[model samples]
Each structure stands twice: as C-alpha cells, then as structure tokens.
Target: MTRVRRGVVAVVVLLSVVLAATPSTVAASSVTDQLIRRLNRQLLYMAVPIAVLVEIILIYTLWRFRGNDEPRPTRENRQLEITWTVATALVLLFVGTASFHALAHPSVSTIDGESSDVPDDAVEVDVTAEQWEYAFEYPDAGVATNETLVLPENRSIYLSITAEDVVHSVHVPELGLKQDAIPGETNLLRTELTGTGEYRLYCAELCGVGHSGMLSTVEVVSEDEYEAWLEDQRAGEADNESATDATNESSGGDEP
Candidate 1:
C-alpha cells in the first residue's frame, strides 16, 4: 500500500509538471483562453487529490487488511464515503462556478446597447465580400481596393461588413472577431490592436469553389504612416474624379 501511494504521487507530480510546460497555442488567440486555463487547473486540482486517495484505499484494502486464513465480516464506512463524496462535489462546484463567471462575461458585442468599444478616433473600414474575393474600403481614408488592410496601433476599428451575392464569414483569429455577411443583412465587428504586427484573416464558411481563396492580411502600422497613406489615397482619388468628369463633359457635348 505504501509503495503504491508513493508511485501514484510521483506519476501525478510528473504529469502536472509536463502539463505546466504547454498551453494550447490555438486556444491562446482568444480572451476566453484565460478562463479555459483557469477552469482546467481547478478541475485538475480536484481530480489529482481524489484519484490518489482512491488508489491508496484500494491498495490498502488489497494488501494490508486482507485475511489469508480467516473470513472477515463486511463493514461499511458510511461517514467516510459521504465525507469524500461531499468534498468532491464541493470541488466540482468551484469549477462550475468559475465556468459560469466566464459565460456571464460580456465580450465585445456590436449587437446592441452602447457599442462605443470601438474608439471614436478609429478609422472606419468597410469590407465587402463577393464570390471568393475580398475588397477593403476605407471611406475615411478615401481608399477602396482589393488588398490587405493596414491599421494603426492603439486605435479601435469598426468593420461594417456585407456580401454582394451570398453569405460569408470574416474571421480574424488574432483579434477573435468573426461575423457573417449576409446578402441582405449587414454585420458589424469592433476590434482594437494592442501590439503592432501582421495577422491573417479567413472566411469561416465554404461558400463556393474558390472559397479557399477568401483570405486576406491585416497589417498593423504606426499612426504617422496611416495618416500619410490616407493623404496619398485622397490625392489619387481626386485625380481620378477629375478625369472622369472631363470625359463625361466631352461625351455630353458631342451627343446632341
């Protein structure tokens, strides 16, 4: 019995140490990851102790209390059983309580109420999805093109997304934002970047044959760079508008 208890302790300790070294990388992408880790720890804390206790009891009953030549009357320890059962229930209760706390948490939702999570100083971007292509439209910056989105750090962003013909979902794993773009209904996503870097975005649903091509990049840039780029796009847009107006005037004058 003693040897068995020692072995169980050693195994549990080794398992815990090994597990402490690795946390799921895919899970860390969301804010809820912290909740998941905490819940896991709580459950482990309860399970490890109970499992060791059970192993000790079983080994002790088998080796120390067994009679080789005499028959023994069976006796029940109701109090002991109830005590361990209640303790286990209490531990599970703690885990359940923690999970409830996470579920009750209010994540960044643009569904209703005051959606001021996206800072007022944010640069608005409209993302339109069609077939298998992605088009990013920065109205405030006078930029509309089928390319990656560059954002400024420490700024909140509001994405008003929609689809032209079918339904699609825009998913950014790093930002933990995914929203559906229905053909008739528009969806909004609000997010902020704390660190400056690049991230990948993908379409969550399989829409059509080229659904795999529904991918994009998000580049986080400095505030100064974002403002300068916005200026360049505005200048270029003005030039295009002037050429279009000149062509329209020439065509109208020659029509009749």
Candidate 2:
C-alpha cells in the first residue's frame, strides 16, 4: 500500500477506536449544565475532524516527494484558498454565537450593579467566605448558618458572594456554578434549583492552610420544609436574645 493509503487507514482506525470508547450520552442535572455539555461536545466534534484532516495532509505531503532532488514551486489555488477562508470564518462565527448563548445565561454569568433583572421572588442569600469556612445568611428570613446552605427547590436563587479575608471561590460541580469571593466586593450569582438534593460545595481557590478542609453542603429542600426551617431558626434566635437581655438586667440590678 502507498504511504497515503496507510495514513488514511491509520486515521480511520484511530477514529473508530475513539468513537467506540466515547459514551453515547452524558447526564446533566440542570439546564445550564446541559448547555455547557452540549457546547463541549460540539467543540470536540469540530476539533477532532479538523485535526485528522491536517494530519492526513501533512503525512501525504511528507511521503509523496521524499526523493525529489529539485522541488518545483507550489502553485496557489485561489478557489481552495477562498473555500477554506469562508469555512474558517463560518466556524469562528458559530463558536462565538454558541459561546455567547451560554455566557448570557443568568446562571452562568455574574450580575453587575443593581439587580433589577433578578426575579423579585428569587431567594436572596449573602455568602461570606473566610480563611477556613463559609457563612450563608438569608436576609429576608433573618437566618444565618455556617454548616449548610439551605435552598428551596424549583425557585430562583441570588447569592451575593464576598470574602472576609483572602480571595476564595465557591464551586458546586453538580450545579455547574462557580463564583469568586473577593474582599470588599460582592458578586451576584443567580441560579434556579430544579430538584431536591444535597450537593457538595468546595473552595476552589487556595486561601490558607485549611483550604482543603473548607468544604460544605448545599441542601435543596421543598418550599414547605424550607419555610418551616426558617421559622424554627427565627424562634431560636429570639429565645437566645431574650435570655441574654434578662441576664443583663439581673446583673445591672445587682450592681446598683
């Protein structure tokens, strides 16, 4: 077989092996995740074919004129050049369009300035990151927790993320969400929960010695359950405040 024929055969065999190893489908839990996965697959498909074609052309050119003592100057083909130029432009346009579609999504991008675009009914939570831990506060509910981030399923969420110390990042792979927490600056991350489940949260940036231990859980619960939990927390906070006030009064009376 000629060298060009061997190269063609090799390319075919390699493609077959890769196709067989690739999974038919990958499951995604959220719409944003699905969009990202689709974009990745599209890029992969385009890249593989382009790489293979380039390699085949390189191999053929190398082997076809191996023993030529005097090589003639190559003639330019305007038609081929124009065809490839147009093709390249179209490919770049497609990539830019697809990327913009994904990036414009509220769940994928951060909000700037006033959050007028944010839904009025969206749950608002302030996320504070320190050296070794994260704190979640629900301003509307007047509840705060450092253990877990509790969110309501099937509802839009707006998280105002900031850092108390060094820079940190909140990453939730399952939700396809990541936002940086910078000191004195708050970034808004918006997303809608689709189901009730526990997702792992991690600090993607290395902040300090305990960076590895900065882990938490995001718990998505039903609307009713979330309301009940918030009520319980409020009541507990009220009782604590009352007890502290009574103790202070008793100490003052004894002092006089």
Candidate 3:
C-alpha cells in the first residue's frame, strides 16, 4: 500500500516538473488573460498536495480494515470528519480570496487603464470593425489606419472597440488579448506589447462573406517609429470607409 501511494506521488511530481519546464512562455500580454491564468494556476497548485494527502489516507484505511477480519465499525470519528470539513472550507476560502484578488487587479477592468479603474492618462485607440476590415482611430493622434495598428511598447494602451456593422471580436494572440466589439455598445480591453515586432490581429467572430479577409497587422515599435507611423497613417486614405466608397464608385453600386 505504501509503495503504491509513493508511486502515484512520484508520477504527479514528474508531470508537474515537465509542465513547468515547457517552453510555452513569452508572448504578448493582456489584462484578462493575465488574471485568469494566475488565478487558475494557483488553484491547481493548491489542489495537488491536498489531493495526494487524501489519496494516501484513503488507501491506508482501505488496506487496514478490509473484509470480516476487521468487521466495519458502526461508529464515526466525528472529530476527524469535522476537521476534514473545516479543511475543505479553508481550501475553498483561499481559492476565493486569490481569485478575487486577480479579478480586482486594476488592470482587469480595461486594457492598459482606459476604464474608470485605471488612470485616464494612457493612450486610447478606437477600433471599429466591419465585415472584413479593422479600422483603428487614434483620436489623440488624429489618425486612422486599416492596414496596420502601430503601438508603443512598454506603455499600456487602452482600446475602445465597437462594430460598424455586425458583431466581431478583436484578437491579438501574441499579445494575450481578445475582446468583443458589439454594434451598439463599446467594449474595452488593455494590453502592453512587450517587444518590437509585427504581430497578426484577427477577427475571432464571424461577420459576413468577407470575414476571412478581416485581418490586420499589429506593429510594435519604439516611440519615434510609432509617431512616424501615426503621421503616415493620417495622411493616407487607408480607412475602411474610403476603401468601401472607392469600390462602390467603381462598380456604380448603391449609394451609402
């Protein structure tokens, strides 16, 4: 019985080691993902030891009092039962406290602190989604870009998102972010790109026939490069509205 319990514990430890060593780290980060992962990882971490202890106790009890040789006692160990019940409650309480802490992190309220919880001094970008395009509005910069979104690294940027037509979700996998854009209401999210690189921005929700082409690029650049990109975007007619108008004008389609 002792050997079996030891083997099970060994396996658990081995698996935990492998999981911790895996090279799945390093990527873009968002507030929602950060909080959820932290809370869930902590919960599982707390559970494993308790589970192993319970298994060992159960195995010993089963082996010691088997069959008629040790006729099952009718009396219950009320004290032991009460102790276990209190332990279970304590575990649950800890889980709740940790989870609440994760949720309460100011970052969870919005991306990069555009929400009421975070200071309003951060950069704000208005992202509007249509059938197959992601049009971003940098109100402070007076620039809108459809091809690529240029963001500054290390600083939190808040995104206020809405749909121009149907429902859509903006997702930047490397940034550890995703949020829905509804037609009537604005949804917000915060993220900080840790490094300088070009990442893919995708529409996670379906909209229409051209939804597959609803792809955009996320470019993380230094302060100077970001400012230059903003200026260039402001001077170009790369917004979704301009593209749609040009298409309709060429085809002589219905007026807007």
Candidate 4:
C-alpha cells in the first residue's frame, strides 16, 4: 500500500482498538440506567461502522481522482439513489424506534395522564430545590434530610421533584435519573435501586450564584439500615421540637 493508504489503515486500526477497549464506565445502578446504557451502546455500534465506511470511501475517491484531467459530469443512477434512500430511511426508522423504546421506559420518563409502571411498593420521596440546595422529604417516614438522600437498595423509588425558587434539575447520573425542578410544577422520576452504594447528586441547571455548589449524595443502603436512619431522623426532629417548646414555656413564665 502507498504511504497515504498505510496512514489511513493505521488510523483505522488505532480507532478500532480504542473503541474496543473503552467500556461503559458509568455503572448502571437502576433499571433506568441499564436501559440508557444499552441504547447508547446500540447507537455507538451502529454509528462507528458507518462513519468508518464513509471516511474510507471519501479517502479512496480523493486518492483515485487526484490527476489533473478534465472532469466529467457525473451521471445520476436512479437505482443507486433509490437504494441509498431506502437504506437511509430504514436506518433512521431503526434509530427512532430504539430511542423511543428507551426514552419511553416507565422508569425513565413519566408522561401526564399515563400511569407509570413503578411498583406499588415504590418508596416515594419529595425533592425540593432551592437557590443552591436540595432537600429530600420522605412523607411516609415523616423524615427529611438535606445533607444526604437515603434510599433502600433493591427497591423502587419515585421522586416528586419541584423547585422552591428558580428552575433547577435533579440529576443522579449513576441511576440515569434527571428531571427539571420548576417552581409551582412537579415532575416525577422513577427508578429501582439495584445495589447499595453512594452516588453523587447535582443540580444540573444554573439557578443562581451558588449554582455550582449545589451538590448532594444519594446513599443506598439495606432496607433495615434505611429504616433505622429514618427512625433516627424522626427522633432528632422530636427532640428539637421539644426543646423549642420548653424554651417557649420558660420565656412565657418569666414575662413581666
């Protein structure tokens, strides 16, 4: 092969090697994540070969027609045009179908008036976003936390997200969960935890000056551990309320 051909071969080989070695590093911790990862890999596999073929064809055409000769008008081939058009349409159809399959997954998106596929026992949590912080409240457990979101492993989770101030987004990349938190409007996100671990959470939208610092943690633990944590939070809240009442009574007694 000539020098240019050899260089092209080397580049293609290197790209193939890199693509083969690069594994999906983002761990899928939930059903939503798994679906998203699978769709991404499907698209990548389809796109890479097409891209490589197009590049190879372009390179070959440039090299083969490099001579300074009179250019001949290209004749249109109806058969070739029809074949390519049909092939392109099929590829697009496949892409759209695959995308819809993943995007419409109940765990990935919840549309209005459509009943979600989340399990009946799914743990529901209310997520409230402010200027620079996220607060999580477990209505059933009657516990709330701002520092960390505690969830039970191997269980479905439903998050009702809303903003108290400007627009914000709740994004937990590990679980492939992201939803906008808009003031006066609530958005729902569903996912099932598949493992126990700590995942980073962030506000994906620019809300205010402290937007960059809007961060938190999602800690998925065993069911027993989650129950214990909720109990602890409840006890702490009770103690704080008792102290406030005692202070109020003392102040009232000492009034002139």
Task: Give a tens-digit lDDT track for model 3, residues 42-75.
Answer: 8767876766676667766766665557575578
In model 1, the clashing pairs are: none
The candidate scoring highest on TM-score is 4
Error of 4 at 245 (Å): 2.7
The parts of candidate 3 lying over 4 Å away from their true place are 1-33, 58-74, 110-121, 209-213, 235-256
Highest-lDDT candidate: 4
Candidate 3 residue pairs in backbone clash: 28-174, 28-175, 29-175, 111-189, 111-190, 112-190
Question: For each predicted model, how many residue pairs clash, with residues at least 3 apart or on different chains?
Answer: 0, 0, 6, 0
Per-residue lDDT, model 3, residue 219, is 85
RMSD of each: 5.3, 3.1, 6.1, 2.7
Better by TM-score, candidate 3 or 1: 3
Which structure is stronger by TM-score: 2 or 3? Answer: 2
- Summarize candidate 2's per-residue lDDT along 1-256 as a digit string, tens digits: 6766877787787688558545448566556666777777777777677776787687668777878889999899999999999999988998888888888887788865337766778899999999899999999888998999999988888999999999999899988888999998899988887778899999999898999999999998999999998998899999999999999999999994
Tens digits of per-residue lDDT for model 1 on 160-179? Answer: 88899888988876766678
Candidate 2 residues lying further than 4 Å off, grouped into runs, are 1-13, 16-24, 59-70, 242-256
Better of 1 and 2 by TM-score: 2
| lDDT-sorted candidate list, best first | 4, 2, 3, 1
